[model samples]
Target: MSSAPKNEIFTQVVLEVFKVGGLLNIDGDKLTKEFGLTASRWKILGAIMLSDNPVTVPEIGRYMGQSRQAVQRLVDVMAKDGLLTMTENPNHKRAKYIQMTTKAVDIYKQLDMKQVKWAEGLSSDLSTSEMESALKVLKHIAKQISA
Candidate 1:
């Protein structure tokens, strides 16, 4: 019988990651659906909310590891829905700054509360330190991958 290559270990890890990612995506979708939002839209809103200043579509896209065009489409949809507004960007005439509207802020707050509850429910067994450690590990892995 032929032996599996050592690199197969890395391949298996990646496959498992993808599988878990799909499950997480489904859970995220269900959570966003409850707020009448999609995962992409929520991510955009989150990026804006966490930012210290108004951000451009490209900035949000880069932060989310998505394409500019994809982020622009979401920006357009949200703008049309009165969830966000696009203002002129002095830094880049070609790019517009995105800002959340009051209604969007309200929705975001509600979603934030719901997210907290969901996390609490899901992580009832995990201590706060454990969660922090997991986050730190994930961030480290993400930085390594990006590098």
Candidate 2:
């Protein structure tokens, strides 16, 4: 017996998703370039800011679908640069709580505003319902893959 033909349409859509991810990274780098931030740094910083409290490097890795070692390397460098601070975690002796410094908060706020405006401009020609549907579909796909 032979397997059925592959889903060409789904494959094409998946490829588009990959392409869009690359474009988003490029645009993110451009937005953060003036703030002395790269796409990687901005993502990690944004993760901490969005958490609204201290989190561990492992937590950030899980949230971003990255490796804990990769997050640790970035966190260590950021801490040295004074953008991140480490506090003792009562629950885990080895896992320190990570938080953004005041300076990093200021930069994050500025970038957040820029990101809002950029998103607005990009979605201006699109319908809100369409955007919502697209977001739902993309998130569903992500959830499926991660599961």
Best-fitting candidate, measured by TM-score? 2
lDDT of 2 at 120: 96
All candidates: CA RMSD (Å): 3.5, 3.7
Clashing pairs in 2: none
Candidate 1 residue runs with Cα over 4 Å from true position? 1-13
Residues 77-126, candidate 2: write the lDDT tens digits: 98998999999999999999999999999999999999999999999999
Q: lDDT tens string, model 1, 6-84?
A: 6786577568878977787788788889667887798899999999998999999989988999999999999999999
In candidate 1, how many Å is residue 145 off?
2.2
Error of 2 at 97 (Å): 0.8
Q: Which stretches of candidate 2 lie over 4 Å from their true place?
A: 1-6
Best by lDDT: 2
TM-score of each: 0.85, 0.91
